[model samples]
Target: MIEIDALTKVYGQAQAPAVDEVSLRVPAGSVFGFLGPNGAGKTTTIKMLAGLLTPTSGEVRLGGFDVARQRPAAMAQFGAVLEGSRNVYWSLSAWQNLMYFGRLKGLRKARVAERARDLLTGLGLWDRRDDKVGGFSRGMQQKVAIAAALIADPPIVLLDEPTLGLDVEATRTVKNWITEQSRELGTTVLLTTHQLDVAQELCDRVAVMRRGRLVADLPTRELLAGFRERDRYEIRVEGTVPPGFEAVTREGVTTISVRVSDPGEVYEVVARLRAHGAVLESLTQVQPDLEDVFLALVNEPSHAA
Candidate 1:
């Protein structure tokens, strides 16, 4: 539902582009993760998509409409809650905020009321709907912000750092909302979050950016599987210390780290452990998470250079 083609953003003549020639396509009803380290241009790209910032070159299309030229029609396809919950009013009640935003989106009053009621209640804020946002907790405020974004029932949602300062529980709430939006509601989500676990579990596909350039984009599972260093393993032994083994604390468990390039090397370690009369506890293969992939891409000498 969202298409970007060689989009570029430049602030000054001599300065590097905040967003280079980045191109991407987000399928309808899918959750696409937009990930990068700080200053990687995720925000800049989203702004261009949201019609908040004009791109220096190329184009953005939303719901098949050119966002630059058909801006009103393109913006009608999506609703957004950017960083700091800036889209919502601090003084307005949750109900009022959602209704106002719905009106801004050109939703009919009756439809806005119905959607506002459903969304606020769904987010467990029905009781607080009449309370001023200034009196609500950070989590509560965030929920209201999300409700506002969805009040128009737009087919697409653009969320940037939605769970930024919330506690674990609140973050989980927002993550589940993202999951449900794609899985059950069929809403296309373009998400940018610092939370890797959220991206790993919730996103269908993720695109990693570095220094305004696209580094990697693939299915979440496929992307994570690519980061596995198959030679690395950790084994826990209870009885005796093998001659060449030294225990390292990993997640409160003492594990002997070993690197085996082949099956024979693994067998050699087992043979040595048995020879030492060691009692095997557990054996686990090491796999990298989204954060690992992100760090590897952003910190690469090639990307930096």
Candidate 2:
């Protein structure tokens, strides 16, 4: 539902582009995670997709409409909740905010009212629908903003740090809501966040950026599986670690992690630990998660160079 083609963005007089030839396609009804550290241009790419910023080169299309050439039609295909900004009117009640945004999208009052009720109720904000958003907690306010964004039932949603500062409960609620919208309503989600665990759980596919370039893009499970194939193990012991072993001590337990290219190396490590008079507590294969894979990808020797 979203297509970006060789998208490049260079700020005034800057030698390097903020986003360089970045291209991606997000399938309809799928959750695609856009990940990068600070200044990696994820936000810049998002701004271009939202038509908030003009790209120095290339193009963005939403639901097949070119964002730059068909601004209104492209905009009608998506809704965005950008980070570090208030997405809703603080003085407006939650219901009012939804109605206003829905109407702005050309939705009829009766249709918007029905959607508002359903969205507010689903977001657990129905009770406070009539209350001013300024008086609500940050989580509540965020929920209201999200409701407003979806009030028009746009097919695509651009969410930057949707669960950033929420408490655990609120985070879970938002996460579940995203999943439901994608699974049930066939909504396409383009999510950008620092929360790797959340991305691991929700994103069908993930793309990582570094220095304004696309570094890695793959299905979430495939990415994790590639990292998992590495033979790494974590060994915990009750005594001193031998020389040449990197160990961390915590609560009287010495932990050592090592990667082996050969199965024989496992026994060699165990024998070395035994020779050091260390009482073995446990030995387990290390399973890499999204964070582990992400760090490895972003911190590659080439990236560092």
TM-score for each candidate, following the candidate numbering: 0.95, 0.92
Report the lDDT tens digits of candidate 1 across residue range 31-144.
999999888989889999999899999899999999989989998898898995456888889999988988988989999999999998789999988989999988888898
Range of the 10 consecutive residues with the lowest summed lDDT in candidate 1: 245-254
The lDDT of model 2 is 0.92
By how many angstroms RMSD does model 2 differ from the true structure? Answer: 2.3
Query: What TM-score does model 2 achieve against the real structure?
Result: 0.92
Pairs with steric clashes in candidate 2: none
Q: Evaluate all candidate structures by whole-model CA lDDT and list the values in order.
A: 0.87, 0.92
Provide the lowest-lDDT 10-residue window in model 2. Answer: 296-305
lDDT of 2 by residue, 1-305 (tens): 99999999999999999999998989999999999989989999999999999999999999999999999999899998889999999999998899999999999999999999999999999999999999999999999989988988999999999999999999999999999999999999999999999999999999999889998889998778877855888999998988888789999999998889997799999998898899999998888888988888888846421
